[model samples]
Target: MYTKELFHSWVPKVLQKIFLFVLAIPLLVGSSIYTANMGDMYSGLGTYAETLTFANYSSTIGMMVGLGVILKIKPRFKSKNIIVFAFISLGLLTLAIGSTQRIDIIVVCSVIMGFIKVFGMIELVVPIMFIVSPKGDRGEFYVVFYPLILGASQLVGFLTANLAYNLNWNAVYLMSAIILFGCALLCIALMHNKWTAKRMPIKGLDWFSIVSFTAACLLLNYILVFAKQQGWFYASMNLRLALAAFIICAALFIYRQRTAAIPFFSLAIFTKRRVLTAIVLFSLMGMFTATSSLQSALTSILQYDARTNATINLAMIPGIILGGFICAMWFKREGSTRSLLFIAFSCFLLNTICLYFLISPVVDIRYFILPTFAKGLGMALVYISGGFYFASSLKPTELMGAYPVVIGIRSFIGTAFFSAVFSWGLYQFQSDSMMELANGMDTMDAWVQARGGGMQLYASVRTQSTLIAVKELFGYTALAGILVLVYILLHPFHHLHRRQLIIRRKRLKGESIDGLRAESFDGKDITATAASVST
Candidate 1:
């Protein structure tokens, strides 16, 4: 073992904790900054819109892949040292992305960056959880964690947008690189090089599953993102080929998972009813949240610049904070996960309804504040509660294996899949609306001629069609939200019985009543207990 002192003995432990907390912010923000500032990148990088989505997909898939192997990788190096390496790697990758115009290079860099970024995050997150909840109370930790991640992301998006607006999109990447490099230096200065666990050889990892799953996801992403541009599956040979490749890769991944001696993800977790329900809910949440992409359409139609659109999104921060607060309180009180989900879906439904009416060619930014708040609130609730629901369903032995799947569905696969579907739906709706409007435009031609002639008529038709398509999409999402909300309401309340059983079992084991109560109340506690069991 190597011992290297970094922070002086005089540095207070509280200050060290603060340093860890601060170090975590950049790691979380850096992962999704590019996706958050998509519009600016589209204009500045001069890449096809699908290229941005592909980059995002690649990064997300990379993160998912990284997470699958994190436990196996962690014991190999000192936590601080690995984090510093990740920071340096991310810094270089950020610069690489900024310096490149090649779409393929951008995507490849994003994948590597995403993979490296998660190591830094996991190193920081475990420590932060301890700091936030010294006694290992996960509710307290989540109260801080959800708001910090969600709110900081929003704030970073706004700041990056401002940076892009004032100085070009490349400036955002430069700024991220500088911040990452700065974090590396800070980590070196503020932390000692020490291993948290015994050094174990990296072994038994299923690399085949990782590669196959990544290929499968990327191929599916390509098909979805390019489906509209390529004229759907039948119209484009590339789409057909991508679909076939995706099918083959997916099959290979599943086969390996089923047969491997030590699979990347254990197939048994899917047998849990609560886990399956969580997956479905997560998919719906992704679809509902994906509608936020349409907000860009509203902004574009209204001619809002990148800064203005970002400013509008800033309205979501307060609601995110509020949602976090509510979730924390709910968890502390041992509230029903079903009830929490109902509230979450209700927020989504409300947001959808608000946007359904609010999207139009002529609309003020102020009109978006409510819907944006609701969207943020819904996102926070779903994220926190959905994770709890999923984690609570499994034993500790299964958690590390299942966690990557949960994150993959919640953050990447589900969101990306719906985003593509919505994109295609929007395109079809816009085209159909335009054709219908154009067919009726002869009566307005004379009127249009009196105003600004053919150009004005075309612009008017285009704007109206976009607004109509967006509204129609929102209307459909609203209906889906309603159905989901109803399902949540009708879902049986079995969690209470399960909690009672846990409490009884703990009592029978002669555990402290207070500890049993605390442990049985929150899924995060279950997760922590599970982690302890696995370790």
Candidate 2:
């Protein structure tokens, strides 16, 4: 009986803070579970590089539609408060799905994870944030609680990722299942909710948007999964898949949204320029940092074993926490977002320097730990600040639409594009280096003439040779970081304009005379509490 509404009614300070900490636990644990599962999820699909790309694509699309489907289905449920109950109820199912690795199982888990995210983490933060302090003290909450919880989550996740890399990939899934179940238990024991939204019945389904969305996602997934094995357009299957998917998506989106009662996506949210920019920036940064392929650099180029690779990432905990802590303080005192971003960029540069010069078989784990921390520091700066950025920019009324779209698009598009770009680069260098080594090899003729068992011997040589050639490919990541830096500096705001905008988002509150958050789509009138935004 005591849930979101009960927590909201009259929970006292000491109890509320305890519940909020408990609320944060599942999220932290969930993130760790997610990162760990991802570390091995695609191991069976392809090479380390290919596996990384496939996992990114699958996870992104699964996440995007998970919310879309939930939004559509939730309004149709008859039970009052079903939104809250429906989300939390799926916990064990998530455990089951995560624990199993069959495509069917993983697919199920991804869908559920996406489904629960809306009412679970996103909304919970709002209440916990508002209740944690007096109505006016937003900046302090961000400075203190936000970083601590986020750092805790990412640290656990970072630890899990490394541990999985060393253990069997299957261990990742099992661990995630255990963690998720534990979180569910903790939720029942400790979480206090303060839900106010009434349940909505699904009047009509957005069949058009749904089809379009599915087709678009499926098409993209096909491209990622089978592209290497089948070859791009040369594979008749790829061409057929692309053609079929694009047509369905194009035709369905136009035919349905103009006519449906509840459209899956509102076209209106993109109208806000600042919000749009923020979305793009957020996506790019995530794509740049989190792709599983980055692990290849640590494992392959650095010539470190899985255990060592995991250890290097473990070192990131302090820096990640430090960066978030610093940014929150910066936001409270100076209210300067640009300064926060500038700090992120500077740390990024230092990280790139670490990679540019230091990647070698001779390089010890100690050498890279600082660099890892520096990179993490950059991530911490942008990430913690970004949460505040979204809360401030969008009113509560528009929250679901604005927050999900920004998070969804940024993650999906950024992941797909970056994975494609980085993999292509890795492939090209890998191909070239192998060819060069093969041409120079003294045993080339004999290797080519070998049969059956001889072919196996040749394969081993090829594997070893290819690993050696990947040195050039490893160097490309540092270059990619440089490219990202250049692009960020080129943004029109560069520094001063961005600084002012961050302050403006926080300062103006309701003064945004344009009714900036007033726009509505999908029938919900979205608005944010000044208190909520400040938090």
Candidate 3:
């Protein structure tokens, strides 16, 4: 994260700030467009696991390689001509192939677009740097803008999802292109390479890890998204590819990081037991919480069978909103990290309890309500308290890049992988139970009914073993939650905690009399300390 010295001497040069505002808008939306069409892309990519795998493979590799190129060739605060080129190229590439159904062409075009998206992610900020011209506001500026980008993504996702649905995929993509091009024009005006001169050391390429990770991710996506449709290898080639992808990815990822001079991942980062523990705990807690997959589990187990499965999975929104609202209010009053974390973890465990032992078969939907609502609230609590763990744990520099990477990896890869594991575990356990029970009868109705489904092929229960499968998913997630609790408890984050204490001491000592005494572990403390003081 940035310190005050990183900001411009005074106000951002007006022209540059305006230019950055223009540049920031679309780079934010590009990903949302991807997300809005995320479900569509999976369905549209291809039929088999191989096609989907390659589709994902191309996107992942392309994005990584593209990001690598940007970091290598233009890794700086210099003139962003190359970045501008990358942005337009990716935007057009993304726009061009949005409605495409042809699998081969989609893969090729997606690879090309990968470069564009990667470029935007890496370089879009290049332009925004000009706006943060006030060196003192560097950290503060990041606080203001980073969420602008993320919030915009959410906004675009919400805005476009229905539009895509209503207009057919054709106009949706066309609109995506138009929005991107608009962003490109903004970049041309606002985005400049500010960090071009003070370059961060560029790491070399890890083709094996890159390919393997990408393949694994894509494989996982295919397996997760289409597993039920394909019957989870009880009936498909996709399973073979998925197993291969996971093995290849896991093996290569571990090997490359262990040996590479500058590995894509650093097992060493976890040398700080606290960071490792935090990652483990966060990851564990993440496994069962109101993730998209968890919500899906809820629907699958709750007998909410419909032609549309994804739709039944929206129980977590109210929970999330409630969490956000509680956080907003609570942060305004008793900004207690310990309290927030306790509430979140407790609620999370309690929600697990709700799903685990309390949920009953033949229960009202109301029985299911509390679990998701609690989950949503819990996520907010974790987010706020997550700041404290990071603060109390790592060094300033470590804090800057450390947790953000955790955030990114968790969102991008970690969550998905765990999701696959959860589902696979459920399938294995449930299928085995179903088989063991059915072994006695060998009759269709007896077997179906025993598995908790109706004998009728078209009946609601025909598609749902909601209670059975969910109990399994919840059981797995709960175990993960336990792992999280243990790791966090054992972990040592005293280094960052010391830093936070020092800052708080200085602040109380009147260091922030005119300005914030807080330094960013990538701005986690940005508004937090102020909120704490107010409380």
Candidate 4:
């Protein structure tokens, strides 16, 4: 039977596929609702911006933990039941997020929602993968898959922004909860409660490793998010203690992973050169993407309210679609990874340059379109290319074990660290600019007196200083992008198609292809140890 038939026999196969796709939408949206409506959440909850950052960090960490354990979790329950439970739990969490005034409660709920949401995502993604690539060719599957995921994310961001703009920020959460609950009902009606795979006993699940890793991540996030406000590491008692706790937790988790009979995830994956290279590339991508946070500050400086800012972000959708199209075409041709990285960084450089020149106190909103589009396109390219690169660097058995580490580094750890650094840099530049501009202002002059005295003059200075600070940050980012692009040009890289051809030739000749398989199919040494199997 086809995978679509697994859903239900009453409907046509095509219709079942469509139905499953529709049900998947709510799961996707609910997973990222907090991030899409970040500005509104800050306003509604009356909390510091760091609180929201912590909430996002918590959710992402939870996602990492979920992905780590999902293999074990899947065998214990039916796909349909997992979907139902995930949706109901996420729906209630959505309500809880909307109902609460306490940031702590919202964060706790976000972490739990993040964990359960993965179960639902897997059920949808696996069937969709079967439909997209029945032959189980990951390259072919990703050509279609990346675009779908990125497109949905951009669309969700735009819609949620509009919802928050039209109603209250809390309304977005309410809408999400309603959709989730509705999906739970649809799952009950449309999907069967039969297990798709044979039942396996759950054993040797290292729950301690998961908890320790999560605690370490949260502690590290707490330090980053609050460092600026608390006066960095040396000045704050809480920050110092958090750092100590983070070290202990991280050490414990690493030790457990190394010594435990069934490690939560294999640490051996990190020993590969290609995997390390992918991590560096992903870190750079994260830093580039984190610059988008400056858009909020820029919009606020331009006196655009939340709604207008959200409207401006809609400009990214077209670029996102275009980027996906490019990736699909690139993968179809089995293009060079170097060429992809070059194009991606070029887009980022262009985005930074555009924003650098466009940061004025008074500028047309239309001026933002090109930069935002470039930003969106760059993001899509990096995300897709990075995932493919990471996957190619590992063996099939190692893929699942390495997934959480790659995702955690790419999505949470790298992004959060850079975001905090950018925030701190912006603050420092703004402070310097403020003092310099203030020193130059002649408050006693007749023109200044005519302009409503000291308060008016101070406001003008602050505005100009903010504009200068933003421009400086963008300029620095552009320089960094240029260096990366040059490195890509100088690097020795082979086309993925060429590598695949070599592998095929080696296989046909009955030669040992183990070395090629060990290192992105690049004909490397095969002496590397295999990844440890998780129990």
lDDT of each: 0.80, 0.55, 0.54, 0.78
Q: Which stretches of candidate 4 lie over 4 Å from their true place?
A: 1-5, 492-535
Q: How close is candidate 3 to the true structure, as a TM-score?
A: 0.63
Badly placed stretches (over 4 Å) of model 2 are 1-13, 28-63, 66-90, 98-101, 132-150, 158-205, 254-262, 290-298, 301-305, 386-392, 444-487, 494-535
- Ranked by TM-score, the better of candidates 1 and 3 is 1
Q: What are the root-mean-square deviations of the candidates from the true structure over C-alphas?
A: 5.2, 8.0, 8.9, 5.7
User: Which of candidates 1 and 2 is the stronger one according to lDDT?
Assistant: 1
1-535, model 3: which lDDT tens digit per residue?
Answer: 2221212334366655565555556654554225444455555554553354445435654564454344444443344555566556765666657756676776777666654665555444544543443342232333344335444544555555666566554566677667666766655554443443555555466678667656665556566545655777768887777877788776877788788786655566677654664565466555654344555555544555321332322445555555655655554453544455656777787678776774344556666667756765566556544644544454433443354346534443455556566666666665666655545543356666666554443333322444566676777667766665555455443335556677678877876544435443422443322111100
Global CA lDDT computed for model 1: 0.80
Candidate 1's displacement at residue 210, Å, is 2.0
Point out the worst 10-residue segment of candidate 1 by lDDT.
Answer: 526-535
* Model 4 lowest lDDT segment of ten: 526-535
Best by TM-score: 1
lDDT of 1 by residue, 425-530 (tens): 8899999999998986664566777988888888888899989998898888889888998898887534456667777888889876674443344443444432
Number of backbone collisions per candidate, in order? 1, 15, 24, 0
State the local distance difference test value for candidate 4.
Answer: 0.78
Candidate 1 — which residues are off by over 4 angstroms? 1-10, 443-445, 493-535
